[model samples]
Target: MTNDDLQFTDDRPITTQAQDLLDRAGFAQRLALAVSSWKNQESLVISLTGGWGSGKTSIKNMTLDHLAAVQGCQVIEFNPWQWAGQDSLSSAFFAEISRVIQREDPSDDDRKLAKLLRSYSRRLNTGASLADGTAKLLPILLASTLATSLLGTLAQGAVAQITWLGVAGASALGSLSLILQRSGAWLGRWAGNLDEDAKDSALTLSQLREKLQKLLSTRDKPLLVVLDDLDRLSAEQMKGIFQLVKAHMDFANVVFLLLFQRETVEQGLWKAGFDGADYLEKIIQVPFSVPAIASSQLENLLFKRLDEILAQEPQLQQRFEQDYWSRVFQRGMRPFFSNLRHVYRYSSTLAFHCRLLRGTEVAEVNAVDLFALECLRIFAPETYTELSKHKALLTGSDPYSRQDEPQRVRTTQLMDQLVSLAPVPHQAATRQLLQEMFPTLDWVFNNTNYDQGIQLRWLVNSRVCCDEVFDRYFEMSIPEQDVPNSLLHELGRRITEPEPFTILLTSQAEDRQAEILQRLIGLVEEFPLDQSVEVVRTLLHAGERVGRKISFTNWSPRQQVTRLLRIYLQRFEQEADRSQSVINAFALTPGLVVVEQLLGADHALRRKGDVGYFDDSGLEQLKSVYMRKLREKADSDPDAFLADGDQASYLYDLNSYSEGGDEGRRWVEANVTSPDRFLQFAQGQVSVRTTHCGGTTTRTSYIPVSSLESFLGLERWTQWAARLDSLELAEDQCRTLALVKEALAQSEQSVTAEESNR
Candidate 1:
């Protein structure tokens, strides 16, 4: 989808039935009816239990929405998470109920109820604790109504940041000490009148409870207090909340609604040295598990989102294969999603990646395969991360030669680990999906093998099974050094049109020219035989213009183009057809070096008596066509021919193709008239060799006397040496000329020795 049409789905709980993707409205409506129909005088506590992200909050909100029309029902939502890591959870609970009661225009009864709540809280805060026969001070800073007010002011002002930690750090040491001293004085006074204070406090609290019960009993509407996300609170906070509910459970015409993930709440309570499940059973009068969303419903919602996104790109929709998607979705994706939250998460992540990759050449990736891979990215992130680093292991073919059993064993172990990252129940499905996407792993899992012939089809179709385009799928864009397949296709289509084709080929940067040529070598393998004649001719023309700039490595632009031509020519099975394609290419374009290199491969194969593309006669005819062109170029502009970028290889080919090196030596002798020209000629005569030393290989270039003698006769070489020696040269020039003369003397010694032996 385009950026304008795309949006990430949020994780908010749905408030109305219309917003519900799963069919939970019926259950929510039934719950609302049950709560509204309650006529008992005793307080009711209902617990909505489910796993996290299982739509408990959504169901709760929808139930509240259904109850909004029922008269005389009030909701007080107290999110315990807001007061997390604080000592004010109990104070905050009563304050919320009092605030909601006071929110209505405060009648005398409402004000009286608020006053009774304050008095009861004060008694509880001032009461002495004797748990385990030890006098332990409670967190009294926020227990009373006056103290809660002070806590609110401090939280909104200077100590706001520290309040979240609930007076539990070195930063609050002084403040906590001052608070303890203030409460300690009150405790001391109470201790002085211990018997009297205890008796009076007990009577006063009993009187307050009776008054509060009578006040709540007269109310026409029942009060519903909702406490959600209870499990998100700390362990102490969860215990405090449950303790608060238990202490206040005797009130009349009041209902408490608590929603949480059961396991999280149980774990939190258990950490605080309480039997969590037993603690919950004591507080919660009635419990209802949030209904599980069906697998089909989740898939429907996911597919609906996917269709909306995929509809924006018509080409991707056309490329989507329904059969493969079904296999992957049923076997691989169905296990991970158990709720609407997962569907939204997967859709949002998929939409973001699709937006980045759309309307670009990288969008040519197979849509079904990308969908499955994106699924893995979300559900099995570790596997996705390692998959990027191990492309060769995933996409590489089984070896044709001897097998390395140890390497295969290692690969099998790694593949098992990757599949094991998924949920245990889905591991088999994950393995099946991986094998379907990457057939190379078939050998590891099922002992199935794939040959190298199918690789071209995979590459041409832009499947992830090919290494060339694998990075684009993960990076969401083409890598800088890699050529885009769109550009490759465009070049192939325009190969017959020489001017535009040459411009396109030469327009790439010097650093990327070698890679671009390498990709084209694969692109040419897919070309049809009918177009080979014109395509080869245009490629030769382009290769002449794109001659060897910063591409001096083994796979230079020239070498790549030569390889491309060989693959393109093999499209024609008959030797005559291949020879004619090469002849026609040379007849239209005058590139001598590239044609010579192309035929050289066949010459080696033919000499070894292997099955080659061309016979001796066909090779000679094609050579004669380029040979005539080379002679004309030498005659017309000899300086330009000698100044070619690959002049060394050209001169070598020239001597080897002509009779006894007469024609090539004449051209060289005429060109080597000056000291600089002779130096250039000598420099071009150097032989390159790679030698291994101390576990590393080094390339050394030196002019060999025998090669120079083979190119130019000894008499001519001596004439040039004497001419250079007679001149008064610079220091560097004399050094260079001396090296040449030293090698020439060695050549003379070898000639003398050979003559004496004869």
Candidate 2:
């Protein structure tokens, strides 16, 4: 068949095997004989059972399809699960059978008979109106009609004998009995609502037996019942179905054919109170298992199906190779033949992808490549990143210090230094440092399988390289036009200010550790900085141990060190409260100039009662005084200061600027000395805004500062102007009055000199 034909057939129900097995004529003959014998004697029960995807439903349909040719026998089909949870199970069951009987034979009398029977069943079950129940003697009416017909023939001088009359009466009774029994059997098949009352009724095995007996009389035809999709029911529901069937085993000439996946059915039964094998023997009169098809046969089937699909769309035929079809078939179709649902799902997915690839340059699809792509889609970026990090750590070189190897001391020292920056416990810090330095080397140490380790190592190495690329992209100060197409570039565009790496590095003193931190911060900010704060904290905690000790004697280097200390302390203070450990760490640094500068600024601002108006020089002087006081305290008694009663209060007073109107603006202008400096400070405090009187007394304020035009150079003015314009305040307002005053003074001096020369 062509591919198009295969696609079309995929939409149709599968019926070729069933039709082939039971040739139409032979099946019809067998059905008629079965129905005839069942009507004559009700002691037989028939069940049709098969595994999922087997033809249980199809066979049942086929049996009913030929029932028209049978004499004195009727066919009725009832699906119990459909009647689930309704109170009157018996009434519903009888109602369905009555409808079916009326439809099969629709004479006026037949319709009346069906209506009477249905009403009778409802009255019996629900204690409802009894008019219909009284009319249920229609079967007796039918028997009397036959008796009258027989007597009428005798009255016409045919000389009918009494023995003949008895035989006829008996035959009529048999037919009526069969009809009534079927109607009753159908009623019993209803899965009664499992309310408290129904639950109690369910436990009464005798009631079920009596109902079953009334429905399936001993002289009636054995009923064939097929239960499909049993796996769809919950364990309790499944148990209910089984219990119902078992309870009525003696009353009905009924055969139950249960269909489901073997494992699902067994598991469900186990959950519902019976052991697997025993439950199967009790409920499933015959269990048929579906075997997995051979890999080659599955391949053939797939190819056949594909051919049919491509027949309508002939262009698709050339898109796949013979081997490709075989591989896909083996991977998706060879696992479980009983699970037709999975088979269809997998095949459909493959077909869809194949259809998508049709007419492309690539002639064949790789199953492994497709599978990997699917897996990647299912997993997330974070998972991949973590896996890569772990791989790098496992395969990388040792990072821990080795006491025996003195020659490796420098490397060990470097490792130790890196580890000290991380805040995690010693072992974790060491591993993290090693991961950063030689990411892929950890896999070797991990003892993973060679292929897995190598693959993981590749991913790890790739991630590390990507991180480095981002760092370099950020580090290089290029014209906005020259920005590299990298993750850092994307991150920079997202942030209104400079990259976090740029901020971290430029905001503090230049040092090796600071530079590393700048890079790390940039990467973290790109994804989610808050989420990665723990990692950054770990790094910083580790790095603190290796830095040089602060000293006041060497003022130049000491100032730089002090600045770094201030930056760290400010960051810690901003991010977290002044914990004893953090405060102690700050006190350990030798120079208090930086800390003093910050505290003095706070005090000066408080003294002025207006933080917004304090100039840069004034703030700097305050910081110096605060730093000096901090140094004095630390020198006098560092341990005592850490445990001091006023430590928290002092830190609070130092950090806190008065919250008066325009205080934030005053602080910005006071602390920032130059245009560039002011801009940086402004960018940091951009979010500062104050409102009063619920919008009635609102005012916008900004710090006034001037740039050193010569220092910026003519070429840089445009960039500076752009930066200035981006601020929340007006561009003209940021120009300081002091600079204008200085310019006027210079102009006056120039005029005086010119006049004298003249």
Candidate 3:
């Protein structure tokens, strides 16, 4: 898939005209008809309730769309959650109704009704009705009495001779006068001119409500007001909306439609101190619960989109296996998608990251395994994150690499904790999925272990369970110094073409070259049968140059290339075929170092009592051919042959195997006439020594005195050891000589200690 195909789903509600994947369109239409045909003059409050993300909004939008065709009906939508305070909610609700009336119905009486509605909303917000005024008047009088008593006590403290009772009586009279002046009817009876404006203001709320009801009753069409996202509001705000609908705004010819999650609203209402179910039942004249989407329909929708995404990647299709995918999908991926939003989210995540992986071919991941991991990534993000951090524990790569009894028990506990991060219902399925991907976990779950051979196959396929490729699954990109499997796969295809194959190897960075060669070595087993000889030839040629400089303490580029040859040889069924293929590649190959290493592996295997693809006679023939080739190269250009950095060890091996150790020493002595030659000779003699200190193990490369004596004899070795510091030696030669002298000193001390002990 290309980057252009990478897009994320925003989880937007499906448009009213768009095709409904959840099969709720029919119910929405029927509900719309019921709403539009309602003949009741009293305000009808209809509620559409469901759980969050259960497509309540979509069904509501669709029902409104269907209601649009009704001639005598008008719709007004207000999102109460957008307003923070109760006063704002009440004002915005009435403003929305007034806006609909002014925009849709331009009649003078309807305009007057809209103005009355706004005034009524303002009066309700201000708590200015007669009942509210009377209810608040008693509290004012009580507060006034308490303030006067406190003032009287303070005045007596100022005037020491003043009587507290007499002061309190005068203060009470002043408070009563202020109350009468403010109220005019309750306290202003003796106050002058109880104003007409004050009286009119007191009755304005009742007048507005009666006029609004009369005007709404005369209207031909009912106004349907939709209050959506009610469940998203705070308890107080949501309760205010309910109060505004049930008690305050119950005007004739006006229907209120409330959209929210039932359980959420109920809990919020309960938190506000009331029986939520009873309050909702009293407010709602008609309640409609959103229908539950069918699981099969959701599954079909999810798979159809997944298939569309899969179709963009042909390589993914080729790698896709039906049986394994079916098992993983049913057990692992299927459980995560219960609703339409879940499906969209998973599909978007898969598409976006799959595009990234496809563009890079970072891990050569199996498409099905990637799908399962994405299921965890979306549904169980914590588990996915834990998997990335605990790669060794999950892949069994480290201390738990071998599943002994103790390790198994420990790993089982860790695995149980890991799987428990998923939802409770999905824990079992997630564990099973992990087992299917990582066979190392099988022992913990199934009391069995897969053959170790299968892990090599997993590496070949770039399965995530393979420790080397595990990071790519989580990282979604390649790490530094790692080679792309796409390039390695291309190398396999280009094995027949020497120039392109060489170019591909040369294109990689020096550090990445080793990784590329290593991955190519792993892929050798899967190279086509017809390209076996050519593949072997190409790898040996590449190895001579690519593998020459890459050396670890225990592994050499020579061993790496030889391993590639050996794995490729296994494709041949008969021993004769393997021998013939090796001989054929050696004949076609140009490098002496890689061929010698390949034959050296065979000789070593034979010494270990294994046939090693070449029986006794065939091994001798290949060695003879190798010796002849080496002699020809040496005879043709001795300087170039000696200048070759990696040839020293191979030459020593040839001389020792064909002739004897004495002849090998004579040849080495003759060749070591210059400092450069001696450096090359010393570099070849370098042996890696491993030492463990504290908890760390380290490998140090140094030439040993005993090993030097075996190649150079006692007298010649002594001559070189005596003048080691005097000569102008290179860094590597100097280091080697220092190591040899150190070894000699340690050996002498050891011998003396042994004699003393005896």
Which has the better lDDT: candidate 2, or candidate 3? Answer: 3
Question: Judged by lDDT against the true structure, how good is candidate 1?
Answer: 0.74
lDDT of candidates 1 onward, in order = 0.74, 0.42, 0.73
- Candidate number with greatest TM-score: 3
Ranking by lDDT: 1, 3, 2
Residue 714 lDDT (model 2): 26
**Which parts of model 1 have CA positions greater than 4 angstroms off?**
1-8, 69-72, 83-95, 101-181, 184-221, 243-253, 269-285, 303-334, 346-403, 409-511, 525-534, 547-554, 571-585, 610-621, 645-686, 695-758
In model 3, the Cα lDDT at residue 548 comes to: 51
TM-score of 1: 0.73
- What is the lDDT for 151 in model 1? 57
On TM-score, who's better, 1 or 2? 1
Identify the candidate with maximal lDDT.
1
Please provide TM-scores, in order, for all candidate models, with all chains considered together.
0.73, 0.34, 0.81
Give lDDT tens digits, candidate 1, residues 39-84.
6668899999998789999999988998886653777888988877
